[model samples]
Target: MKNLRLERCGITQYDEIFYNLSYDELFRHETDAALPDSERGVVASSGAVAVDTGKFTGRSPKDKYVVNEETSRDKIWWGIGPVAPTTNNSDNQQISEETWYYLKDLCLKRLNGRKLYVVDGFCGTNEDSRMRIRLVTEIAWKAHFFKNMFIRPTAKELEGFVPDWTILDACKITCPEPQRHNLRTPVFVAFNMMERMTLIGGTWYGGEIKKGIFSVMNYFLPLKGMGSFHCSANMGRDGDTALFFGLSGTGKTTLSTDPKRLLIGDDEHGWDHDGIFNLEGGCYAKCIKLSPEKEPDIFKAIRRNALLENVVMDAKGVVDYSCDKKTENTRASYPIDHIERIVRPVSRGGHPSRIIFLTCDAYGVLPPVAKLTQDQAMYHFLSGYTAKVAGTELGITEPKATFSTCFGQAFLFLHPTRYANILGRKMEEHGSQAYLVNTGWIRGKYGEGERMDLASTRRIIDAILDGTLDEASFETMPIFNLQVPREIPGVDSGILNPRNVWKDKADYDKTCRKLAGMFMAHFNNFTDTEKGRALVAAGPQLDAEADAAYSSEA
Candidate 1:
């Protein structure tokens, strides 16, 4: 098998190529590049190397594309396209095979005569299911990022390392002509599944590289009948494993890195008949407004060799974690081993005993914590409901409801139902309980209500993990039909039920119905099949009488 062959990808020229450098070596090169003259990066007070992503600080979903060739054209879930533009509305936008090749040649030419840093690593920790990946980039920090984020090979393993897939990240390059290439923007993240290659340009956001591989695994794992998840997993001392599913800003990484429990993985995982395994070797945690008091595990992980992206620093190079002047998506990338508690050697665990679906409900209409039936688990999984407040996105003054199917629509390749089916079957087979925990607000919407305290949420999560909540009495919530616990050990009973804490009960009822309607409308995007209809019933309902009765009961 060929190993580290850039020539095979049609590039004959490069200044220098370094392969699998140690963290110290990469850090030396990174700091050198950040010299006074070069605007690359600097060492922060915490000893982490901090760099700015310039224009793009987050993943660009719209610019992402998949080559609609014979191998994947029929299999990909290319959802409906826009009426006027003639492109899919989904994140997996379609690009012709010809256009993909055109961009490939451009990417190759841009790397010519430029220094390249190549790193070889594994994606999944399970040797049986993991994919050997090679990342070739021009930036030393990016090479470091890939090394920190992926499972590093040992000295013996690196001898014959051949990547199952490869990513060519030309962070400093962009297409010269979007009109001629028939592209939306000069920046493009085009993937050709048949070729087992991904081409990235115009964005230095390291997440694009990390998540691009995840999309590859999402496609392949499902084909192998294994479940790929955009969630966090950890194991308790009692041998109980739990998975946390949610979108960004919703505590997936923060909550799952429990000090008491052994963290299996923080971001992504895969589940098969055997069990679940961590997909990546590291944690890419959002560190905006990060504090040691709130998140002890993640805070301490930011030490020497950790990579901080787009985080603001003062004149003396001390990091201001609360500053969002650059972007609200300030992040820190560090290997999982940085944490004090974790599953050693291999990050794999038994079938999860419980699954928690986390959502930051800015509207504050949903109960703080609610239990779900198996069907409801699949329904909520498909819905993947979460809300974004004013500052989270570009142009939001109010809380906007966002639903990314399966909590990771951006990375999914197959239909949403395919993944939902696998989850439902696995849950039924293993008897895994599901719960939805809202960490957003308490009394009212974003403007009026206070955010849920981290301590209280942790207490609620502890109850679920320790099996205390299972014995507590549950009451049905209106419209959503979620079963809320009557009382939690450390949590106030008044805040357990959302309506009880709301200042205006009638306004609460109105908001609940509006959110329910949004859920129903969003579910319409899914195909109308027998299973689809069944899962639909598991979601929220809007009945006038039910709302009135629920208001009076509160």
Candidate 2:
């Protein structure tokens, strides 16, 4: 039976394979191997294992490919239809079946004579919607990472386990002569949906392993009339659920891992008729400059069975979370059980009562907290805007505007409007309210303005969760038409309206108008259906209001 399963996984030949080893067994194997070579990584003082990703510290989007076969040819969004191009347009690049077979054969040849590590796991927490997955790797630490990131099957549950999908991870090998092979680079991540398999090579970055499956779920779930989101979710004490949607560095993981609430999941989730379910069993949190004072839960959770990637450490195994010597994208991956406050036994929640769209607006023009009309919510959902600060990347000296459709464009399989439409129906069906919270600057743009204090952002979130801001007085902000509350209990009212804190009101208007115009231009990429048109129409009016204000001043 085991050989048959291996044959089914296209593993007809191998020197040896270790299947479904316990956590301690895998950890022992990994550490024993690493003892001789510290470069492979060592156990940190905190009991977490730290390793470095070679060649790349992040995902390679251009090298990611989707097979243009019968299963997903017409379904996948090939490109943004006829608008100004953006970075996200590189998503869902197509590859031929011939190319997939060539790469698959190369990877399997490399794995044939080697000792292999295989792990069996599940992705979705919802029993009905979950996908069974089998991951085969050449390294034990990556097997440990797969175990940490996915829902671990019980001893009895593994009795007759067969995977719904299989991933062959050949992380060390690279494709040769890319031009002849129809590849963007030597490093490639190709998903063949028809075969229910993914092949990864030439990069040791662990994110590619998890996100490869996430991209699959983003394709399959929506076809079943369910919603797959790249956002974080948590539940209040009273069973009220909330979701925080944002791209990286915009505080999605930071805000959702609330000490006061029970964390459902920190990264990806699914919404269906049965409510919300976590797509993974773990949290992958950014740890650059991480401190207990700011993020006590994440700080404390990074011990005993957690895995750290690309973090700097000393000879004594002391990790400096502040050091970016390796990369600013240093990360910690740990199971949800590591958290003190979490929904036990299950990582599921009821339908959301509120959805907060967090944006790090570097221009300092957006209000700290604003209630969003459903149309406005849909607009922002499709826009999915955030800002990348200076020093985060090379050549980014000032705040650079970044946008991802649904805040996860890189992982989406269908057109972005598909998910937006599903979210709209679900929110309306459940009567969920929406809010836009700016966690960026307050007084002026970037260098001139001060970043909003973490305490202030937390207080603003508390007001929303406690239902205190629902009945507060609100006024419409110009240019964007967002309804901003005049006051909150613990937050300074002076910063509530971003325009009020600015030293120069004219500069604020100019910056705000510039941002509004950027929104209008970027949103033009969508191929609008009637519903999409409504969402687009609900966005900021680039000229009418701002033009009227200028004329009135004249």
Considering every candidate listed, which one attains the maximal lDDT?
A: 1
| Candidate 1 local lDDT, 197-218, one digit each (tens) | 9999999999999999999999
lDDT of 2 by residue, 319-347 (tens): 99899988999989898899888887999
Q: List the residue pairs that clash in candidate 2.
A: none
Worst 10 residues of 2 by lDDT: 79-88
Q: Which candidate has the highest TM-score of all?
A: 2
Clashes of each: 0, 0
What candidate 1 gets wrong by more than 4 Å, as runs, is 1-3, 33-39, 79-89, 391-398, 544-548, 551-554
Query: Which stretches of model 2 miss by more than 4 angstroms?
Result: 1-4, 34-39, 80-90, 391-397, 550-554
